[model samples]
Target: MTASLSQLSGRVWIYPGDPDPEAVMPCVAVVADDAGSTVVDAGQSPAHARLVQSALAEAGLPAARRLVYTHHHWDHTWGACAWEVEEIVGQESGATLLSAEARRSWSQEYLQEQVVANPRLGPSFKARARAMTGWADFAVRAPSRTFTDRLMLSGGIEVRHVGGKHAPDSTVVAVPGSGVLLLGDCFYPPPFHLREPGPAGEEIDLRQISALVAEGFDWYVDSHSPPWRPPVPE
Candidate 1:
C-alpha cells in the first residue's frame, strides 16, 4: 500500500496512513508557515518516515523542521529518528514513556517474551510485533522537549494534552490557521488490555472533546481515520 499527501486546508496537509498487512501506520500531518513546517505524528519506522518526506518533497514543502507528537504510541512516534528535525516535542508523560520504551529490545523474541510475561498485552503486542522486519535498525526516539499541559508554537499551532481512555498521555493539536484539529487517537476506546469489559467506568471526556469541537474547526483529523467534520453545537 502507498500513502498520498492531500491538502486539508490552507497551510495544512495530511499524509493519510496506509494499513498494510505488516503494519498499520498513523496519519501524519504537516502544518506549514513562512519559517518551516511542523510535522505531527512521525509514523511507524524510518521507511514510513521516508514516504512522508517524499510526499512533502513532491508537494514542494520543505522537510519538517520540527516534529510534534500526539502521544507516545509506537505507531506514531517510532519514526522520530528518521525525521531529522531540529526539534521534537511531546507531552511530558508521553516523552517519559517513550524514553522508557527506547530502552527495550524490539526483537520478535523479546516481544513474545513480553506477551508471555503479561498475557494482557498479547493482542496488542502481537499486532505491533508483526510489523517488525529490519529490527536491527529499529530504534525508538524520544521527544527532545516536553510540556505538561499545553504548548503554543509559531503559526497559530497549539498542542494540548487531553488524556483519554485510549492513552492517558494522549494529545490533540489545533491549527487555527487552517481550522484543522489533529485529534491523534484520543477518541479511541481503551485498549483491550485495559478495558474492564463492561459499561464505561470513565468514558472519554466528551466535555473536553466537545469543547474542542465547539471551536468550529473545519476538519477534525485523527490517526488511522479519514478527516471528518463533527457537527457543531448550536
Candidate 2:
C-alpha cells in the first residue's frame, strides 16, 4: 500500500495518507507537471521516505525536485533527509521549529532519557522507540524556502498559509489545475480529535467544511486518513 500511487486529478498523483492507529506520519501527495515533480510532504522516517521515492520511481516521474511541509511536526517533516530534493519549503515558523528538532541529536541514550522523562509515556512506547534505531540518526532537513503568507510556485501550485484547525504553521496545498486540495491533518474523520494527543493542537472548525464546497475541490486529502469527496451542497 505504501508503494502505490493513484491519480487524484490531471497530473497530480496522491500517495494515500494512512498511518498506524496511533502513528502520525506523512501520507504524501505528488504534483508532477512540466516544471518537474514536487512531493507535498516528506513522511515520518527514512523508511517512509523510501516508500515515497519508490512510488515515484514506479510512476516514472522525475525525482521529486521540491518538497514542501504542511507543518513542523516530525511525522511530516522528518523524512526529507532521505530524498535528494532540490528545494525544501515551509512556513517560517514551521521551518524554525523543524530546524530545531532536526538539530537535536537523537542518540540511544537520548531516546531512553526522553521516554523516562515524559510522565505521559508508558513502557511499551519507550520500548518501541528503543527498538527503532533507524529513527535515531538522520537529517532533519529544514525548508530551503520559507513564506509567511502565501506563495505560488512557478509550476502553478498554490500554497496558502491558512491558519485554521491545526498547527499555527499549517498551510493548504492546492493544485488549481486539478482542483485538488491537500489538507494536512487539518480536518479528519470524527473531525473532533487532535492530530496529536493532548490539547496542544487546534480543532478544525466544522462549519468551514461546508465552505470547502464553495472553494470547489474535486478531491480532499488528509494526513492520517484516506482522501474523500467534499459533501455536495443541495
lDDT tens readout by residue for model 1, 51-134:
899999898887788999998887888777787788998999988888889998778898889889999888767867765556
Kindly list the per-residue Cα lDDT of model 2 for residues 160-220, writing each as its tens digit.
8865655678878988888888878654322222345655444456655555557888888
lDDT of 2 at 218: 89
- Structure candidate 2, residue pairs in collision: none
Clash counts for all predictions: 0, 0
Judged by whole-model lDDT over C-alpha atoms, candidate 1 comes out at 0.83
Candidate 2 positional error at 81, Å: 0.4
The C-alpha RMSD in Å for every predicted model, in order, reads 2.2, 3.8
lDDT (C-alpha) at residue 2 in model 1: 70
